[model samples]
Target: MLSEKSEQFLMSLRLELLKRGKKEDEIEEVVDELRDHLHEAEQRGENVDDVTGGSVNHYIKTISKEMAFDKRIIKMVIGALFAIVAFFLIPRMVSGQLDLSMYRIIFYGLLTFVLLPLELWVLIEMLKKYGNSKKGYIAPILVALGGFLIILAGEFLLREYDGESVIVMEASTIFWLGVILSVVFILVCLYFYQWFYIGVLVYLVLPDLFANTMTDAAPGSKEYINVSTAITLILTVLALVGALAFYARYKKNS
Candidate 1:
Protein backbone atom coordinates (compact mmCIF):
# COMPACT_ATOMS: atom_id res chain seq x y z
CA MET A 1 0.00 0.00 0.00
CA LEU A 2 1.37 3.37 -1.01
CA SER A 3 1.11 6.36 1.28
CA GLU A 4 -1.42 9.01 0.28
CA LYS A 5 1.31 11.52 -0.50
CA SER A 6 3.25 9.03 -2.62
CA GLU A 7 0.13 8.05 -4.63
CA GLN A 8 -0.63 11.70 -5.27
CA PHE A 9 2.88 12.30 -6.52
CA LEU A 10 2.65 9.29 -8.85
CA MET A 11 -0.64 10.46 -10.29
CA SER A 12 0.83 13.92 -10.85
CA LEU A 13 3.73 12.35 -12.67
CA ARG A 14 1.38 10.43 -14.96
CA LEU A 15 -0.56 13.59 -15.85
CA GLU A 16 2.64 15.56 -16.46
CA LEU A 17 4.00 12.87 -18.73
CA LEU A 18 0.77 12.84 -20.75
CA LYS A 19 0.93 16.61 -21.11
CA ARG A 20 4.50 16.30 -22.37
CA GLY A 21 3.35 13.87 -25.10
CA LYS A 22 5.31 11.02 -23.62
CA LYS A 23 4.23 7.61 -24.95
CA GLU A 24 2.10 5.43 -22.67
CA ASP A 25 4.71 2.68 -22.52
CA GLU A 26 7.33 5.14 -21.29
CA ILE A 27 4.99 6.62 -18.72
CA GLU A 28 4.14 3.17 -17.36
CA GLU A 29 7.80 2.23 -17.07
CA VAL A 30 8.63 5.45 -15.27
CA VAL A 31 5.72 4.99 -12.89
CA ASP A 32 6.73 1.43 -12.09
CA GLU A 33 10.23 2.53 -11.22
CA LEU A 34 8.94 5.38 -9.04
CA ARG A 35 6.56 3.05 -7.27
CA ASP A 36 9.40 0.76 -6.22
CA HIS A 37 11.45 3.70 -5.02
CA LEU A 38 8.50 5.09 -3.09
CA HIS A 39 7.90 1.69 -1.50
CA GLU A 40 11.47 1.57 -0.22
CA ALA A 41 11.29 5.14 1.05
CA GLU A 42 8.03 4.47 2.86
CA GLN A 43 9.51 1.38 4.53
CA ARG A 44 12.38 3.48 5.79
CA GLY A 45 10.01 6.18 7.10
CA GLU A 46 11.60 8.71 4.77
CA ASN A 47 9.69 11.56 3.20
CA VAL A 48 8.43 11.01 -0.37
CA ASP A 49 9.70 14.50 -1.15
CA ASP A 50 13.21 13.33 -0.28
CA VAL A 51 12.99 10.53 -2.83
CA THR A 52 11.85 12.96 -5.54
CA GLY A 53 14.31 15.57 -4.29
CA GLY A 54 11.25 17.56 -3.11
CA SER A 55 10.34 18.42 -6.73
CA VAL A 56 7.86 16.07 -8.47
CA ASN A 57 7.09 18.18 -11.53
CA HIS A 58 10.74 18.81 -12.21
CA TYR A 59 11.43 15.08 -12.04
CA ILE A 60 8.58 14.38 -14.39
CA LYS A 61 9.93 16.83 -16.94
CA THR A 62 13.39 15.36 -16.60
CA ILE A 63 12.08 11.84 -17.23
CA SER A 64 10.03 13.06 -20.15
CA LYS A 65 13.07 14.62 -21.75
CA GLU A 66 15.12 11.47 -21.25
CA MET A 67 12.55 9.13 -22.82
CA ALA A 68 13.16 8.28 -26.45
CA PHE A 69 10.50 8.63 -29.14
CA ASP A 70 9.09 5.48 -30.68
CA LYS A 71 9.26 6.35 -34.35
CA ARG A 72 8.64 3.05 -36.13
CA ILE A 73 8.77 3.44 -39.91
CA ILE A 74 6.72 0.31 -40.51
CA LYS A 75 3.87 1.64 -38.41
CA MET A 76 3.80 4.83 -40.43
CA VAL A 77 3.91 2.98 -43.71
CA ILE A 78 1.05 0.66 -42.72
CA GLY A 79 -1.02 3.64 -41.58
CA ALA A 80 -0.49 5.44 -44.86
CA LEU A 81 -1.47 2.40 -46.87
CA PHE A 82 -4.59 1.94 -44.78
CA ALA A 83 -5.55 5.55 -45.40
CA ILE A 84 -5.35 5.05 -49.13
CA VAL A 85 -7.32 1.81 -49.06
CA ALA A 86 -9.94 3.08 -46.63
CA PHE A 87 -10.60 6.29 -48.50
CA PHE A 88 -10.51 4.71 -51.94
CA LEU A 89 -11.13 0.97 -52.29
CA ILE A 90 -13.32 0.59 -49.19
CA PRO A 91 -16.03 3.04 -50.25
CA ARG A 92 -16.40 1.23 -53.54
CA MET A 93 -16.72 -2.08 -51.73
CA VAL A 94 -19.24 -0.70 -49.25
CA SER A 95 -21.48 0.78 -51.93
CA GLY A 96 -20.76 -2.05 -54.38
CA GLN A 97 -20.65 0.63 -57.05
CA LEU A 98 -19.17 4.01 -57.83
CA ASP A 99 -18.63 6.17 -60.87
CA LEU A 100 -15.35 7.45 -59.56
CA SER A 101 -13.47 10.43 -60.98
CA MET A 102 -9.75 11.16 -61.08
CA TYR A 103 -10.14 14.44 -59.21
CA ARG A 104 -11.98 12.72 -56.36
CA ILE A 105 -9.26 10.12 -56.11
CA ILE A 106 -6.51 12.71 -55.98
CA PHE A 107 -8.36 14.83 -53.45
CA TYR A 108 -8.95 11.96 -51.04
CA GLY A 109 -5.46 10.59 -51.58
CA LEU A 110 -3.98 13.86 -50.42
CA LEU A 111 -6.35 14.11 -47.47
CA THR A 112 -5.48 10.57 -46.31
CA PHE A 113 -1.75 11.11 -46.62
CA VAL A 114 -2.02 14.22 -44.52
CA LEU A 115 -4.25 12.86 -41.73
CA LEU A 116 -3.52 9.14 -41.28
CA PRO A 117 -0.26 9.43 -39.39
CA LEU A 118 -1.80 11.61 -36.71
CA GLU A 119 -4.80 9.29 -36.47
CA LEU A 120 -2.62 6.23 -36.08
CA TRP A 121 -0.67 7.95 -33.34
CA VAL A 122 -3.86 8.62 -31.41
CA LEU A 123 -4.94 5.01 -31.94
CA ILE A 124 -1.70 3.66 -30.55
CA GLU A 125 -1.98 5.97 -27.57
CA MET A 126 -5.50 4.73 -26.92
CA LEU A 127 -4.33 1.13 -27.01
CA LYS A 128 -1.69 1.92 -24.45
CA LYS A 129 -4.23 3.68 -22.25
CA TYR A 130 -6.45 0.59 -22.42
CA GLY A 131 -4.24 -2.40 -21.92
CA ASN A 132 -5.03 -5.85 -23.32
CA SER A 133 -6.69 -7.37 -20.29
CA LYS A 134 -9.06 -9.48 -22.41
CA LYS A 135 -11.48 -6.61 -23.09
CA GLY A 136 -12.58 -6.55 -26.77
CA TYR A 137 -15.27 -3.90 -26.91
CA ILE A 138 -13.09 -0.79 -27.00
CA ALA A 139 -10.74 -2.07 -29.69
CA PRO A 140 -13.56 -2.93 -32.12
CA ILE A 141 -15.26 0.40 -31.56
CA LEU A 142 -12.10 2.33 -32.24
CA VAL A 143 -11.27 0.32 -35.34
CA ALA A 144 -14.80 0.52 -36.72
CA LEU A 145 -15.04 4.26 -36.08
CA GLY A 146 -11.85 4.96 -37.98
CA GLY A 147 -12.94 2.87 -40.96
CA PHE A 148 -16.46 4.30 -40.86
CA LEU A 149 -15.11 7.84 -40.98
CA ILE A 150 -12.95 7.02 -43.97
CA ILE A 151 -15.89 5.39 -45.76
CA LEU A 152 -18.00 8.46 -45.07
CA ALA A 153 -15.25 10.67 -46.42
CA GLY A 154 -15.21 8.65 -49.61
CA GLU A 155 -18.99 8.91 -49.91
CA PHE A 156 -18.86 12.67 -49.41
CA LEU A 157 -16.16 12.98 -52.01
CA LEU A 158 -18.17 10.91 -54.47
CA ARG A 159 -21.33 12.88 -53.74
CA GLU A 160 -19.67 16.29 -54.24
CA TYR A 161 -19.25 15.76 -58.01
CA ASP A 162 -22.55 14.85 -59.68
CA GLY A 163 -22.77 11.86 -62.09
CA GLU A 164 -19.84 10.18 -60.35
CA SER A 165 -21.78 7.92 -58.01
CA VAL A 166 -23.21 5.02 -60.01
CA ILE A 167 -25.14 1.90 -59.06
CA VAL A 168 -23.91 -1.50 -60.15
CA MET A 169 -25.50 -4.96 -60.05
CA GLU A 170 -22.42 -6.72 -58.67
CA ALA A 171 -19.05 -6.11 -57.04
CA SER A 172 -16.34 -6.25 -59.64
CA THR A 173 -13.86 -9.10 -59.64
CA ILE A 174 -11.24 -6.42 -59.14
CA PHE A 175 -12.73 -5.74 -55.72
CA TRP A 176 -12.38 -9.37 -54.71
CA LEU A 177 -8.83 -9.25 -55.96
CA GLY A 178 -8.24 -6.36 -53.64
CA VAL A 179 -9.64 -8.45 -50.80
CA ILE A 180 -7.15 -11.20 -51.49
CA LEU A 181 -4.36 -8.67 -51.50
CA SER A 182 -5.61 -7.30 -48.20
CA VAL A 183 -5.45 -10.73 -46.66
CA VAL A 184 -1.88 -10.98 -47.85
CA PHE A 185 -1.13 -7.59 -46.39
CA ILE A 186 -2.59 -8.59 -43.04
CA LEU A 187 -0.48 -11.72 -42.95
CA VAL A 188 2.62 -9.69 -43.72
CA CYS A 189 1.88 -7.22 -40.95
CA LEU A 190 1.36 -10.07 -38.52
CA TYR A 191 4.71 -11.59 -39.50
CA PHE A 192 6.43 -8.32 -38.69
CA TYR A 193 4.62 -7.98 -35.32
CA GLN A 194 2.38 -5.11 -36.45
CA TRP A 195 -0.70 -6.03 -34.44
CA PHE A 196 -2.47 -2.69 -34.93
CA TYR A 197 -2.43 -3.16 -38.68
CA ILE A 198 -4.11 -6.52 -38.20
CA GLY A 199 -6.92 -4.89 -36.24
CA VAL A 200 -7.45 -2.30 -38.96
CA LEU A 201 -7.38 -4.95 -41.65
CA VAL A 202 -9.92 -7.01 -39.74
CA TYR A 203 -12.28 -4.03 -39.74
CA LEU A 204 -11.64 -3.49 -43.42
CA VAL A 205 -12.01 -7.08 -44.51
CA LEU A 206 -14.86 -8.43 -42.40
CA PRO A 207 -17.30 -5.56 -42.93
CA ASP A 208 -16.43 -5.60 -46.58
CA LEU A 209 -17.20 -9.31 -46.89
CA PHE A 210 -20.79 -8.66 -45.86
CA ALA A 211 -21.15 -5.37 -47.68
CA ASN A 212 -19.83 -6.80 -50.91
CA THR A 213 -22.57 -9.38 -51.04
CA MET A 214 -25.44 -6.89 -50.89
CA THR A 215 -25.78 -5.45 -54.39
CA ASP A 216 -29.20 -3.84 -54.09
CA ALA A 217 -29.04 -0.20 -53.03
CA ALA A 218 -32.63 0.49 -54.03
CA PRO A 219 -35.77 1.23 -52.04
CA GLY A 220 -36.51 -1.21 -49.17
CA SER A 221 -32.93 -2.53 -49.34
CA LYS A 222 -32.02 -1.06 -45.98
CA GLU A 223 -32.85 -4.32 -44.25
CA TYR A 224 -30.10 -6.22 -46.05
CA ILE A 225 -27.52 -3.54 -45.42
CA ASN A 226 -28.61 -3.34 -41.79
CA VAL A 227 -28.17 -7.05 -41.33
CA SER A 228 -24.74 -6.92 -42.93
CA THR A 229 -23.75 -4.04 -40.68
CA ALA A 230 -24.81 -5.94 -37.59
CA ILE A 231 -22.89 -9.01 -38.72
CA THR A 232 -19.86 -6.87 -39.37
CA LEU A 233 -19.99 -5.43 -35.88
CA ILE A 234 -20.22 -8.88 -34.34
CA LEU A 235 -17.31 -10.08 -36.45
CA THR A 236 -15.27 -7.08 -35.40
CA VAL A 237 -15.84 -7.96 -31.75
CA LEU A 238 -14.81 -11.56 -32.36
CA ALA A 239 -11.71 -10.52 -34.25
CA LEU A 240 -10.62 -8.35 -31.33
CA VAL A 241 -11.04 -11.20 -28.89
CA GLY A 242 -9.13 -13.62 -31.09
CA ALA A 243 -6.41 -11.04 -31.65
CA LEU A 244 -5.97 -10.45 -27.93
CA ALA A 245 -5.82 -14.15 -27.23
CA PHE A 246 -3.30 -14.74 -30.00
CA TYR A 247 -1.18 -11.85 -28.78
CA ALA A 248 -1.16 -13.19 -25.23
CA ARG A 249 -0.22 -16.68 -26.35
CA TYR A 250 2.53 -15.39 -28.63
CA LYS A 251 4.01 -13.27 -25.87
CA LYS A 252 4.03 -16.21 -23.50
CA ASN A 253 5.87 -18.42 -25.99
CA SER A 254 8.23 -15.66 -27.00
Candidate 2:
Protein backbone atom coordinates (compact mmCIF):
# COMPACT_ATOMS: atom_id res chain seq x y z
CA MET A 1 0.00 0.00 0.00
CA LEU A 2 1.20 3.49 -0.89
CA SER A 3 1.44 5.74 2.13
CA GLU A 4 -0.25 9.14 1.82
CA LYS A 5 3.15 10.73 2.10
CA SER A 6 4.51 8.63 -0.73
CA GLU A 7 1.50 9.38 -2.87
CA GLN A 8 1.81 13.13 -2.34
CA PHE A 9 5.51 13.00 -2.96
CA LEU A 10 5.07 11.13 -6.23
CA MET A 11 2.36 13.52 -7.39
CA SER A 12 4.45 16.57 -6.63
CA LEU A 13 7.52 15.07 -8.18
CA ARG A 14 5.52 14.26 -11.29
CA LEU A 15 4.24 17.81 -11.52
CA GLU A 16 7.64 19.34 -10.89
CA LEU A 17 9.30 17.05 -13.39
CA LEU A 18 6.64 17.87 -15.94
CA LYS A 19 7.31 21.50 -15.31
CA ARG A 20 10.94 20.76 -16.04
CA GLY A 21 10.02 19.06 -19.34
CA LYS A 22 9.60 15.44 -18.32
CA LYS A 23 7.29 13.09 -20.20
CA GLU A 24 4.31 11.45 -18.47
CA ASP A 25 5.31 7.93 -19.47
CA GLU A 26 8.63 8.16 -17.68
CA ILE A 27 7.35 9.74 -14.48
CA GLU A 28 6.06 6.54 -12.88
CA GLU A 29 9.29 4.68 -13.41
CA VAL A 30 11.27 7.66 -12.10
CA VAL A 31 8.94 7.85 -9.12
CA ASP A 32 9.40 4.16 -8.40
CA GLU A 33 13.15 4.59 -8.62
CA LEU A 34 12.88 7.49 -6.19
CA ARG A 35 10.80 5.35 -3.83
CA ASP A 36 13.37 2.63 -3.92
CA HIS A 37 16.12 5.11 -3.10
CA LEU A 38 14.15 6.60 -0.23
CA HIS A 39 13.30 3.12 1.02
CA GLU A 40 16.99 2.35 1.23
CA ALA A 41 17.51 5.53 3.24
CA GLU A 42 14.49 4.66 5.42
CA GLN A 43 16.49 1.72 6.68
CA ARG A 44 18.89 4.29 8.21
CA GLY A 45 15.94 6.14 9.83
CA GLU A 46 15.45 8.89 7.23
CA ASN A 47 11.87 9.71 6.26
CA VAL A 48 10.12 11.43 3.39
CA ASP A 49 8.78 14.14 5.71
CA ASP A 50 12.26 15.06 6.87
CA VAL A 51 13.64 15.63 3.37
CA THR A 52 10.59 17.61 2.22
CA GLY A 53 10.43 19.53 5.43
CA GLY A 54 13.90 20.82 6.30
CA SER A 55 16.75 18.62 5.15
CA VAL A 56 17.83 21.39 2.80
CA ASN A 57 17.69 23.96 5.58
CA HIS A 58 19.40 21.67 8.02
CA TYR A 59 22.26 21.36 5.56
CA ILE A 60 22.46 25.11 5.03
CA LYS A 61 22.15 25.91 8.72
CA THR A 62 25.02 23.59 9.44
CA ILE A 63 27.17 25.31 6.85
CA SER A 64 26.38 28.84 7.96
CA LYS A 65 24.01 30.22 10.54
CA GLU A 66 24.41 33.41 8.52
CA MET A 67 23.07 32.23 5.13
CA ALA A 68 20.02 34.39 5.70
CA PHE A 69 22.17 37.44 6.37
CA ASP A 70 24.23 36.82 3.24
CA LYS A 71 21.12 36.46 1.12
CA ARG A 72 19.73 39.76 2.47
CA ILE A 73 22.95 41.56 1.73
CA ILE A 74 22.97 40.27 -1.84
CA LYS A 75 19.39 41.40 -2.39
CA MET A 76 20.09 44.88 -1.01
CA VAL A 77 23.12 45.29 -3.24
CA ILE A 78 21.16 44.39 -6.38
CA GLY A 79 18.31 46.71 -5.44
CA ALA A 80 20.74 49.56 -5.01
CA LEU A 81 22.13 48.99 -8.49
CA PHE A 82 18.64 48.95 -9.98
CA ALA A 83 17.81 52.27 -8.29
CA ILE A 84 20.88 53.90 -9.74
CA VAL A 85 20.13 52.68 -13.25
CA ALA A 86 16.46 53.69 -13.11
CA PHE A 87 17.14 57.32 -12.18
CA PHE A 88 20.09 58.05 -14.43
CA LEU A 89 19.55 55.73 -17.35
CA ILE A 90 15.86 56.49 -17.65
CA PRO A 91 16.41 60.23 -17.94
CA ARG A 92 19.20 59.70 -20.39
CA MET A 93 16.76 57.58 -22.38
CA VAL A 94 13.83 60.03 -22.22
CA SER A 95 15.68 63.24 -23.16
CA GLY A 96 18.59 61.62 -24.98
CA GLN A 97 22.15 61.26 -23.82
CA LEU A 98 24.57 64.11 -23.27
CA ASP A 99 27.81 62.30 -24.07
CA LEU A 100 26.64 59.43 -26.25
CA SER A 101 25.25 59.48 -29.75
CA MET A 102 22.86 56.61 -29.19
CA TYR A 103 20.87 57.21 -26.03
CA ARG A 104 19.41 53.75 -26.51
CA ILE A 105 22.78 52.13 -26.35
CA ILE A 106 23.46 53.64 -22.96
CA PHE A 107 19.91 53.20 -21.72
CA TYR A 108 19.59 49.58 -22.71
CA GLY A 109 23.17 48.93 -21.82
CA LEU A 110 22.48 49.96 -18.28
CA LEU A 111 19.41 47.80 -18.24
CA THR A 112 21.11 44.90 -19.98
CA PHE A 113 24.67 45.20 -18.80
CA VAL A 114 24.06 46.44 -15.29
CA LEU A 115 20.44 46.17 -14.14
CA LEU A 116 19.43 42.93 -15.84
CA PRO A 117 22.47 40.98 -14.74
CA LEU A 118 21.88 42.15 -11.21
CA GLU A 119 18.22 41.23 -11.44
CA LEU A 120 19.04 37.72 -12.63
CA TRP A 121 21.76 37.32 -10.04
CA VAL A 122 19.42 38.35 -7.27
CA LEU A 123 16.72 36.09 -8.68
CA ILE A 124 19.07 33.13 -8.85
CA GLU A 125 20.31 33.81 -5.35
CA MET A 126 16.75 34.08 -4.11
CA LEU A 127 15.94 30.74 -5.69
CA LYS A 128 19.03 29.15 -4.23
CA LYS A 129 18.57 30.51 -0.73
CA TYR A 130 14.82 30.72 -0.48
CA GLY A 131 13.17 29.39 -3.57
CA ASN A 132 10.13 29.35 -1.39
CA SER A 133 10.26 33.07 -0.72
CA LYS A 134 7.59 35.58 -1.75
CA LYS A 135 6.41 35.26 -5.35
CA GLY A 136 5.07 38.81 -5.58
CA TYR A 137 7.88 41.25 -6.16
CA ILE A 138 5.34 43.73 -7.56
CA ALA A 139 5.13 46.11 -4.66
CA PRO A 140 8.84 46.48 -4.67
CA ILE A 141 8.88 47.19 -8.40
CA LEU A 142 6.08 49.71 -7.98
CA VAL A 143 7.83 51.34 -5.11
CA ALA A 144 10.92 51.61 -7.26
CA LEU A 145 8.89 52.94 -10.18
CA GLY A 146 7.23 55.49 -7.92
CA GLY A 147 10.61 56.89 -7.05
CA PHE A 148 11.31 57.09 -10.79
CA LEU A 149 7.98 58.87 -11.31
CA ILE A 150 8.98 61.57 -8.90
CA ILE A 151 12.20 62.02 -10.79
CA LEU A 152 10.30 62.23 -14.05
CA ALA A 153 7.96 64.75 -12.44
CA GLY A 154 10.84 66.81 -11.12
CA GLU A 155 12.59 66.62 -14.46
CA PHE A 156 9.45 67.90 -16.11
CA LEU A 157 9.01 70.73 -13.62
CA LEU A 158 12.67 71.62 -13.49
CA ARG A 159 13.02 71.91 -17.24
CA GLU A 160 10.30 74.55 -17.29
CA TYR A 161 11.93 76.64 -14.57
CA ASP A 162 13.46 80.00 -15.46
CA GLY A 163 16.75 78.81 -13.98
CA GLU A 164 19.16 76.70 -16.01
CA SER A 165 18.63 72.95 -15.77
CA VAL A 166 21.31 71.17 -13.82
CA ILE A 167 21.52 67.69 -15.23
CA VAL A 168 24.08 66.36 -12.76
CA MET A 169 22.18 67.57 -9.72
CA GLU A 170 18.89 66.24 -11.02
CA ALA A 171 20.36 62.86 -11.86
CA SER A 172 22.15 62.52 -8.55
CA THR A 173 19.11 63.35 -6.44
CA ILE A 174 16.78 61.00 -8.29
CA PHE A 175 19.35 58.22 -8.17
CA TRP A 176 19.68 58.47 -4.41
CA LEU A 177 15.93 58.67 -3.92
CA GLY A 178 15.44 55.55 -5.99
CA VAL A 179 18.13 53.79 -3.98
CA ILE A 180 16.34 54.61 -0.73
CA LEU A 181 13.11 53.31 -2.23
CA SER A 182 14.66 50.06 -3.45
CA VAL A 183 16.09 49.42 -0.03
CA VAL A 184 12.72 49.79 1.64
CA PHE A 185 10.86 47.86 -1.05
CA ILE A 186 13.28 44.96 -1.03
CA LEU A 187 13.11 44.59 2.72
CA VAL A 188 9.33 44.50 2.58
CA CYS A 189 9.23 41.99 -0.26
CA LEU A 190 11.66 39.72 1.56
CA TYR A 191 9.52 39.83 4.66
CA PHE A 192 6.49 38.82 2.55
CA TYR A 193 4.91 42.18 2.96
CA GLN A 194 1.36 43.11 1.88
CA TRP A 195 -0.08 40.49 -0.44
CA PHE A 196 -2.97 42.55 -1.80
CA TYR A 197 -0.72 45.50 -2.51
CA ILE A 198 1.78 43.36 -4.29
CA GLY A 199 -0.83 41.50 -6.32
CA VAL A 200 -2.55 44.72 -7.36
CA LEU A 201 0.71 46.24 -8.38
CA VAL A 202 1.62 43.14 -10.41
CA TYR A 203 -1.71 43.20 -12.21
CA LEU A 204 -1.31 46.85 -13.16
CA VAL A 205 2.30 46.65 -14.29
CA LEU A 206 2.25 43.29 -16.06
CA PRO A 207 0.18 44.34 -19.07
CA ASP A 208 2.33 47.39 -19.62
CA LEU A 209 5.46 45.36 -19.31
CA PHE A 210 4.44 42.21 -21.16
CA ALA A 211 1.08 42.25 -22.95
CA ASN A 212 1.56 45.10 -25.43
CA THR A 213 2.93 44.22 -28.80
CA MET A 214 4.73 45.89 -31.64
CA THR A 215 2.57 45.80 -34.74
CA ASP A 216 2.85 46.64 -38.39
CA ALA A 217 0.97 49.90 -38.76
CA ALA A 218 -0.34 48.69 -42.10
CA PRO A 219 -0.95 45.11 -43.16
CA GLY A 220 1.93 43.61 -45.17
CA SER A 221 4.19 46.26 -43.70
CA LYS A 222 7.46 45.03 -42.16
CA GLU A 223 7.40 47.65 -39.45
CA TYR A 224 7.65 46.42 -35.88
CA ILE A 225 6.60 49.04 -33.35
CA ASN A 226 7.92 47.34 -30.21
CA VAL A 227 9.70 44.07 -29.74
CA SER A 228 9.51 44.72 -26.03
CA THR A 229 6.12 43.05 -26.31
CA ALA A 230 7.83 39.73 -26.73
CA ILE A 231 10.23 40.31 -23.87
CA THR A 232 7.48 41.40 -21.54
CA LEU A 233 5.40 38.41 -22.54
CA ILE A 234 8.21 36.15 -21.47
CA LEU A 235 8.41 37.92 -18.12
CA THR A 236 4.69 37.58 -17.69
CA VAL A 237 4.84 33.85 -18.29
CA LEU A 238 7.78 33.39 -15.95
CA ALA A 239 6.03 35.47 -13.34
CA LEU A 240 2.98 33.26 -13.60
CA VAL A 241 5.06 30.13 -13.18
CA GLY A 242 6.83 31.64 -10.23
CA ALA A 243 3.52 32.60 -8.72
CA LEU A 244 2.11 29.10 -9.10
CA ALA A 245 5.25 27.46 -7.77
CA PHE A 246 5.27 29.79 -4.80
CA TYR A 247 1.64 29.05 -4.05
CA ALA A 248 2.14 25.30 -4.30
CA ARG A 249 5.18 25.41 -2.09
CA TYR A 250 3.44 27.70 0.36
CA LYS A 251 0.44 25.40 0.62
CA LYS A 252 2.59 22.32 0.99
CA ASN A 253 4.72 23.91 3.68
CA SER A 254 1.85 25.44 5.57
Across residues 1-254, which tens digit of lDDT does each residue of candidate 1 receive?
98867776776677556545567788899999999999998999997888897665668656656886555535656665774565456435544444456666665665566555556556555544443433323864776587668757867756776454333445565466556666777776778777776666566556555655654453126765675678677987897899899999999999
TM-score of each: 0.51, 0.25
Candidate 2: what lDDT? 0.46
* Clashes found in each candidate (C-alpha, N, C closer than 3 A): 0, 1
Please give the range of 10 consecutive residues that has the lowest summed lDDT in model 1: 128-137
lDDT of 2 at 197: 37
What is the lDDT, from 0 to 100, of the residue 140 in candidate 1?
A: 46
User: Candidate 1: misplaced stretches above 4 Å?
Assistant: 8-29, 43-57, 64-67, 73-91, 98-174, 214-220, 223-227, 233-254
Clash pairs (backbone) in predicted model 1: none
Q: What clash pairs does model 2 have?
A: 210-232
